[model samples]
Target: MKILLDTCVWGGVCKELEVAGHDVVWAGDWPEDPGDEEMLAHAYAEGRILITLDKDFGELAIVRGIQHCGILRLVKFAARQQASVCLHVLTRYGRELQTGAIITAEPGRLRIRRPDEKGQPLTCDIQGQGSRCELRRDGAGTYRLLPFNRGSSARQTASAWGTGMWEGIKGAGSAPGSTAPGGETND
Candidate 1:
């Protein structure tokens, strides 16, 4: 994956992503901070996912409707915890990041917002763990669970549920208190 780490993200995250064979660019190493909007623009123009600890970028993308490849916001995570969660999400949600989405990772949970077929944001929350899980909302507004392939990564195992559930949001067991997705929140 090609990634752009915001100036606020821990510098160590860059090395971890690189070690995992991802192409990474850290804004901290830049000569100057280009400000959030410009940094977002650069990330979009370059087709890289922008990872930040800033909520302002979320406003820029959500309320201001800025075009972007993807944005992953890490909230309330310590500098040491950031890289591990970063790698975990990349492994589990790489496809969503590539295609475009605004994802907020807060502690053990993840809030993923993606453009629906009509281009309106469709938001979902995933929490829980144990085995790989698949999600779909039933007509009555309840989520129905199915099993995703245990052998392959979520992105690689993407099935027809693609339109309904997030392809492969796996467990966050690698991070403290993080678990496999078992629940969701519309808000």
Candidate 2:
């Protein structure tokens, strides 16, 4: 799996994935902050999954129509915690993510919307129109993020994250990169 990691994905996860050998690149390696739009564009153009910690990309993907081959947004976790969740997602669900999916990881729960899965697929009739889905971890089932906030006068907030199982990803996780992916070619 080729992944373009956001600045929020710090060293521990970076090292873990790098050692796992998944061809990962960092946003900070760019000449400057590539910004969400440009960063996402780079990932899409290169067929890489854009993994971000900032949830703003979720909003941008819908409102600005940014498309990415795949995306993983790690919500509300510290650097180490984020890394653990990412490792689990990549190790346990890497194959599931290959086909243009929007995956959100929030501690114990993970939610994703793949191109042809089933209920509530992102309406991406063409390429470069990203798949969109953000889910809150609910007991026994998943819940959408936007609909839960839309009816309120004040915006609702999701809870903070927890640490995850990190046993296997150390041995093999999706790391993806060589040249700085922001400007250089993915190869």
Candidate 3:
């Protein structure tokens, strides 16, 4: 599967995904900083799954009625925990994702939003107060929920390193941290 990694998620996550045998590209590697809509279009055009840390793509998915591929939104967590959570989800549901599905990884849980429903995607009230992440679809859609505490089973961890070398090859101006990268910081 071809995957596009958003700038915020470009740190070391792409390496793991690459070892999983997926072709990955970073936003900074593109001709310019593709906005959410453009990134979604590019992913759809190329038949690639979009892996992002931004929720704005959710709105894009709804408005564009995109059905080509899926999106994987990663909720903020400790760096170490985030890596482990991502690997677990990828190993378990990566195959299902090939068919086009949206999966979200939060602090202590993972949720799958299936497009096989009757109408649009479904919305579920997320638990965990003060949670920085919530998964919601536009309307009625089926979802499979999984909850895991600490020390979950290990899945696959991509061994490929420097998968984001192209990022370094490109100038820092396009990187996520710079003022010119996106205009506004999440902070």
Flag clash pairs in model 3: 122-141
Q: Would you list the clashing residue pairs of candidate 2?
A: 22-175, 22-176, 23-175, 23-176, 23-177, 24-175, 24-176, 24-177
Name the runs in model 2 displaced over 4 angstroms. Answer: 116-187
Q: Per-residue alpha-carbon lDDT of model 3 for 61-174, expressed as tens digits?
A: 655675548788888766556556666766666764666777776654455656563333322223332221223222343222211221222111111111221111111111
Predicted structure 3: lDDT = 0.54
User: Model 1: number of clashes?
Assistant: 4
lDDT tens digits, residues 1-187, model 1? Answer: 9999999999999999999999999999999999999999999999999999998987898778888898899999999999999998888777777878777887645666664322323333344454454344557643334344455555443343343433444442221122323433233
Pick by TM-score: which candidate is best?
1
Question: How well does candidate 1 score on lDDT at residue 92?
Answer: 75
Stretch of 10 with least lDDT, candidate 1: 172-181
Scored by lDDT, the top model is 1
Model 1 off-target regions past 4 Å?
117-186
Model 1 residue 95 CA deviation in Å: 0.5
- Candidate 1: Cα lDDT at 23: 95
Clashing pairs in 1: 127-182, 128-180, 129-180, 171-180
- Tell me the deviation in Å of residue 71 in model 3: 0.6
